[model samples]
Target: MDYLRVAGGRVLRPDGRVERADVAVDRDEGTIRAVGAPDEVDDAVGEPPGEALDADGSLVIPGLVNAHTHVAMTLLRGYADDKPLDPWLREDIWPAEAELTPDDIEAGAELGVLEMIRSGTTAFADMYFAMDRVADVVDRAGLRARLGHGVVTVAKEDADARADVEESLAVARELDGAADGRIRTAFMPHSLTTVGEEYLREGVAGAREAGVPVHLHANETTDEVDPIVDERGERPIAYAESLDALGADDFFAHGVHVDDSEVDRLAEAGTAVVHCPASNMKLASGMAPVQRLREAGVTVALGTDGAASNNDLDVFDEMRDAAMLGKLAADDAAAVPASAVVEMATAGGADALGLPGGRIEAGAAADLAVVDLDAPHLTPVHDPVSHLAYAAHGSDVRHTVCDGEVLMRDREVLTLDAAAVRERAANAASDLVERVESA
Candidate 1:
């Protein structure tokens, strides 16, 4: 059997146990063939694997999933900072975005994809315009994603607003099975308040007909939620439900300001919430009641939101931030434990995005990250899980593998030229800012 082996590492099992194991991957099928002892994997494969990745002195964990992000915003990283969500988007982000070209999107997407590979994120959900270019980057970068065209219709003419909704649906339908099934598509409305109710209803209906899930920002801040509540006489989640936008398959970013009733509705609908702790803090968006949401049987995931607000796309940092912020929000140190945040970064994220590659078991998507535990910050690893949530950094990743393909090995990315991507993104960002300024 043609397979690749990840040899001699402590594997983080689905049940959270760490054990010495070797994982065999069926490269042809892009699935985990076996995950067990060295002899056990050999027995399962029926032959020695032709290729192997050294996992010695490392811990093999499922590749992180950035469930919600505007990846191409990597070009806008640090372009605008120290502002609230509404003003930040209106005053800086939207102006810069209006000046973006498809080429700029591609350059920025390559930069974001390169960062994700280097940092061990194998899958993410991106909601932004010019997503065809982002999808191309994902295909070439050997990553998984749920890509969508973000539609915002608040300030547009009726015809233009309808056209935006149609474009989102068209992009979703056209790109559903692209990249050999590694890329899925979603219908993304920019946010509950940023989109009109009629367009949202139309877009969600079209998405349902096309058999795609919906993603959006919801209840991110008091400014966002108060208007919906005041106008609709109900909460944002209820307003979403009224539009038929809430569903088992749908996921929302930032449920930061959601209350108990909204939490109940989310739990009942099986809708997932992607907590962006760093982004929330950066924008002064209220802390998400992550522990409360989880206690209500809601599936909670972690996201970096976008590099503009998050300043980075590192899921390890998200995990650490989620744990810390959750504890503060709940006023309990045990509110979000290491195990919980780690699971959120992996399984919860995959489940939220309706993608694969959050576990390392047989028949699961072969997405894995090897974290080198030999660093000074990680010395005397009392519990690897603890280290993952509290101490680990993206640079700790030694190897990143997705879909049975090695994207990065030994701290060097193999799929894309790191230097070239950075250079292109820098140039694009400079050009974009200049255009926005000149306009």
Candidate 2:
């Protein structure tokens, strides 16, 4: 059989158990063929494998998923800081975004993809404009993604607003099955406050017809929620339900300010929420009731939001932040435990995005990350799961694999030229800042 074997590592099982195991992947099908002891994997495969990844001294976990992000915003990392969400968008982010060209999007996307690959993130959901360029990067970089064009119709001519909605639906329709089924698509309205109800209703209908899920920002801040409550006499989740925007397949970003009713509604609707702890804290957005959401059966995933707000695309840091913030928000040290955060980063993220590859069992998608435990920060090896939540950094990733393809091996990315991507993104960011300043 032609397969790729990841041998000699402690595999994190689906039941939160860690055991010494070897994983065999069907390279042709991009799925796991077996996950067990070396002899067991050899028995299942019935022959020697075609390739192998050295996993000694490493912990093999399902590839980390960044459930929500504006990946092309990597060019804006550290560009604007110390501001609330509304002002940050209006004063700095929006103006700079208006100046972005497709080339700039591609450059920034390449940089973000490189960072994700290096940091062991194999899949993500990206909401941004010029997403075709981002999809192109994902295609070449051997990563999985749910791609969408973010639509905002807050201040536009009716015709222009309608056109933006149409573009989002069109992009979703055209890109759903791209990248050999590694890429999915979503209908994305930027946010409740940033989009008109008419456009949202129309776009969501189109997306339902296209059989794609919807993604949006909701209840990110009290400022965002108060308007909906005051105008519609309902919370943002209820408002979203009114627009047919909440669905079992749909996922929302933030949900920071959601109350008990909103959380229950999300659970009842089977909608998922991606908690961007770093971005929320950076923008001073209210803390998400992650423990409550999870307790209410809402799928809680972790996201970096965007490099601009997160300052990096590192899911490891996000896991740590989510655990810390969840405890603080609930005032319970056991609110978000290491196991919970680990599951959120993996299975919850994949489930939220409606993508595959969150588990390391047979027949699952072959997406995995190998974390080296040889560092000083990871010493004593008391509990790998605990270390993953509190100590491990993205730099500790020794390898990243997606679709049975090794994107990074031994800290060197193979799918894209890391140095070249960095240089291009740096140049693009500089040019973009200059243009924004000149304009």
Candidate 3:
């Protein structure tokens, strides 16, 4: 089998301390086989006979994982910056989205993937409409993703809502293992506000049958806070538990309104939560109980949410925001150590998504990111994890490889046509902007 060796970088292997090593990958099988000094590569495969990427003494980590996103919103970025979640969705985003065609969705998804690859994200969990197009774009970009067919019950309290859920469930089933097993599918009932108990139950049942994940937003705002409390006579987590939907594989995003009780449910149910710190702060959504969740043994990862809300799809920015906001929320400067946050952005994210990735180790898929440690922002690094979490920006990501395929190298993308993506994004945004402004 042809082998590729990456030499001269400091790699963070799963069970070892960060050390300089050469990593060899069996490209034909898409698995990493050898990771040691360059000399060991020759032993593993004669002459390491293939492409050799010189890491140049940079810091290499498992590719950054973005656990939750609505990628097609790239067309809606910066549309309604200062508005609350509900109003922003209704007044700006939803209306603009109403005008989107499949081509528009493809353009936006392509733009989002380009941004993600450039920023070092190897895999992400995405929930949006027109998901076939999302799948197509993500597949073409050579990125790993768990796609969620985001379905909202047409009428919150009607039986029709259950039917809508079933429709989405069917779609998820059809696409669950599509895209060469690199893309997975999930059930996504938009939110408690949009889909009622029946649809939620249907989604839970659907997920149980497919053995896949369920991605959804929960307790993101106080607008949802009181309604869930009044209707269910309990918090969102309690209501979710009543429906048997919370679990490790069922990743819930934006737990901003969840209280101690909900945190307890998450812990007991082994549910994972994705903290979209930048989106929460930008939308003025209350900070999530991240410290409480962590202490309660809940898996917490970081996410950029979407370009529309965060106005940027940068996971490096997400990591920094998560760390700062995590400390601020707990009223302790050390609430989340930089090292821990880096883990949350990397390994923790992979765990939340149930993906076999997020570390440089033998038997692991060759998914990784390389950073130019020689850069100005990374100079004289006191702690590699700290520098990665706090100082690095997405622009500093030098390379991104996913599933043994190089999506980007030296800040140049290899998978998707970035220039075409940019052009289509511009045209799509112009159309959406005109629709929203006129509305």
Candidate 4:
């Protein structure tokens, strides 16, 4: 509740590099009023009457944006493990989610938001049901997000799916630009394997008309392709192109099986992919051809998928996997360098979501995460960016600020009560386990 002066640190600027500087977060306007050398702005705000956070020359980077996720599934993080995507959804996930009341969803989402804030994820995209409750919890947490009305179809021609589409639109209209521009809605049609072509087209049209981004699951697995192409005589990207939906506003979740032609088309069309590595590996979905896509000049972002799949919304863990997997998948030791990995988690993810964030500049949103440079693994830092993308864990994030509000400071949380939220989520997960077992 005081003026925040973060001094004596290495700040990651807008130019994809780091420099020595300090920042004063103007809580009144929820923006960064001044940034300069340690004392350059000290006199700008007469007397510095608020709390002063000592930076002590640590490294600061913009908070990460998780481009795709289902955070409410935090309750189901490890529920259905070691199963293929189809059986995992058919036998376990959907049934469990069906039993979840709106209250249950709110509790889980609250916990998920708390965890993400502490771990330096300032924003994320979520595709889930009961999004009204999700919005309520997100507003309470004081973070930024892109939420969606979740959809899945069992029939090729179900008019009821149209009603679900309407419901999602209603949610979007009510929640778009909520919480001081921290929350917006994207149209989510589940996936190609789950929804038919007509529904996907309808959803895409609605999103395009509404001037919002469309989030879809594409090429997540080869198993998902048989039904779609066999039924529609085209791959997912081709189907989207035929519908005139492949554009900068469309965000595809996974591209593990997108062919070379599709990558070329995606790069040319300016569509982006949100790679979810942990979920792909855990479900034994083939590794997404991220190296090829990047080489094709496609914009690539990283995500944790969902708690039900990867089981946690930890962006730091995802970055590490992406860095290593990108290198190994290319059979080269330099596919995604440290700087590239950092950009994927920050700026690249922002570009994917169509948000005005992912950089620490005077005119940009005040979204940042500060790490303790004194950590054992991060000592003797030859390159701060390298240390951040490789050595620094989520636990090392000492502070996280989004939209100029300090969500967490000095490894302590402020936006929500972490202890109480964890207790409620634990109770909810226990009930879920009992229900899943008895059923």
Best by the lDDT measure: 2
Give every collision pair in model 1.
none
Worst 10 residues of 4 by lDDT: 45-54
Ten-residue segment with the worst summed lDDT in candidate 2? 42-51
TM-scores for every predicted model: 0.99, 0.99, 0.96, 0.95
Q: What lDDT does the true structure give each of the candidates?
A: 0.95, 0.95, 0.84, 0.83
The digit string of per-residue lDDT tens for model 3 on 1-439 reads: 7777777898876753688888887777777878888787668767645776668858888888999899999888877789889888887777788788888889989999999999989989998888889988877898888887787875345766766677668767877666677888788888877777777887888788878777789999999878888877888888887777886688899999888878888888888999999999988998987888999999998889989889888999998998899999999998887777788888889889887678888888888888888888788877777788899888887888887888897889998778888998999889867766776
State the lDDT of candidate 2 residue by residue for 222-330, as single tens digits.
9999999999999999999999999999999999998899999999999999999999999999799999999999999999999999999999999999999999999
Over 4 Å off, model 1: none
Ranking by lDDT: 2, 1, 3, 4
What value does the lDDT take at residue 194 in candidate 4? 83
Model 1 lDDT tens row, 346-406 = 9999999988889989999999999999999999989999999999999999999999999
**Tens-digit per-residue lDDT, 1-439, candidate 4:** 3567777788988777788888887776666767788667776665664866667768888889899998889999878799989899888898898788888898899988988988899989999989989998888888889999878866534778778877776776778998878898888888876876677777777777887777888898888877767888888788878866788867889888898889998999899999888898888887787878888988889899888788778788888888888887778887888787788899888888887678887757778888888877888989998887888878888888888788898888887888999999989988977877787
Alpha-carbon deviation at 198 in model 3, angstroms: 1.4
Whole-model alpha-carbon lDDT for candidate 3: 0.84
> What stretches of model 2 exceed 4 Å from their correct place?
none
What's the lDDT for candidate 2? 0.95
Q: Let me know the TM-score candidate 4 reaches against the reference structure.
A: 0.95
Distance from true position, residue 296, model 3, in Å?
A: 1.6
Clash tally for model 1: 0
